[model samples]
Target: MTDTPTTLVTATGDSAGKTAITVALARLAADQDSSVGYMKPKGTRLQSNVGKTLDQDPMLAREVLGLDAEMHQMEPVVYSPTFVEGAIRGTEDSEALRNRIREEYDDIAADHDQVFVEGGGSWTTGGVVDLTDVDVAELLNANVVLVAEYGSPNDLDDVLAAADAFGDRLAGVVFNKVSDDAFESLDQDGIPFLESKGVTVFGALPYEKELAGVTVGELADELGAELLTDASTDAFVERFLVGAMGGDEALRYFRRARDAAVITGGDRADVQTAALD
Candidate 1:
């Protein structure tokens, strides 16, 4: 595959599902009997294992995708609190980090037909260490795929800005989390506009409520709240409604939404019941 073809999956903003798409593509290639590797060069989410702080995403990729690369090689520069603090204090070694990432990526790429490199949370992430997603893509000479959640007109602007930034390196764009109405607008106006501007639209994935949702247990853990009810932890929450309004208004809003998690005060029995019902 042209000596390990590499693709960098980046995004315009957080929660754009960059990792999901990267893994999906990797799995697809692997299922087709192609050797696929995965890496996340600069990671923000750190996990502590026996006092060794490791990046979470690459570990996920390695375990889930059965990647052959070692954990250290898959995740080269973990943005730990101390690491970032040291960078801020001018004690961090930027060149050393770059060398480590380049060396690991070279080794990983050498062993596979293609490698999927997952970028940081956002395009501008890791600027403190001079290793933004764009910088990484340029460093590795990888084709870029920018993922953006298509909700508003500003999303189109962000994708266009990414196209401007990446120029010829940009392979295409994947629009995610587009609702029915937004998809209609994007198919009619946004895709045509981007095409007119010489941008490649690879795919526009419609918003799937089940796939885009967070489980109730996940939400509880995120908020540090105890789940008091015996409701199923696997229940997905695609929308969150937070307020105390009149019964009619609440009913109207509840009826409009599917798989919603309503958060209100303890005394707001009306909203609570409305949500539960």
Candidate 2:
């Protein structure tokens, strides 16, 4: 194992694909025969499995990448409503939490040539108890890769803010879910503009519905519903169009979705059949 080489993957907002990017990087590094480790230092989404409550992403890392680490170590801090209240009241121990994260990270790093650290949410999501992405990055001494979604000029402000926040530790920014129409201008003008502002552009990936999606079967599992019709669990749903209109209008809206899932009341046979048709 090398000397705890690590990169912290963070994003601008929700659905920015931070976890997916971390997984891809870890898989690529492992393919190149690098001993790779993965960790999500803090998680907001909790899942109760086999009598243990653990965060989702770190469990994903353990299962998908075959990483050998305890789930608690992979996800040291879980944010519950009570935890947030404690943080707000200044009743939580920030130093102890930081020490726990550092000790877990050091253990993971000791066994791997490189480690990929996944941040919780946006840059400021965990600031209540000093567990923000920047805080964790500074604690771990890891470089930062900021993932951003392209929608408007305001996104540029977020990227610049991240660059200013990380400063020299900022490795680069990867634009996610960019529209095809915007791709040309972003690739041609947007990249150069960011570079001129002293922020390196790794690459802008065109928006693919599949990359930012969850399968219908997965949704059913979460909602505890049984599937009556056979649907491909691997299919990625890029959008969700509610069937609220008449058949003609509904069909028109349905056509607009690429790899989308339609949701309607079970009693609405018209909507269901229209979506099927």
Q: Determine which window of 10 residues in candidate 1 has minimal summed lDDT.
A: 43-52
Please give the lDDT score for candidate 1: 0.85
Highest TM-score among the candidates is held by which one?
2
Model 2 residue runs over 4 Å out of place are 48-52, 214-236, 239-277
The per-residue C-alpha lDDT of model 2 at residue 215 equals 79
- True lDDT of residue 84, candidate 2: 77
| Candidate 1 segments whose C-alpha is farther than 4 A from its true place | 1-3, 48-51, 214-235, 238-277
- Distance from true location, Cα of 30 in model 1, Å: 1.8
For each candidate, the alpha-carbon lDDT, in order, equals 0.85, 0.85
TM-score of 2: 0.78
TM-score for all models, in order of appearance: 0.77, 0.78
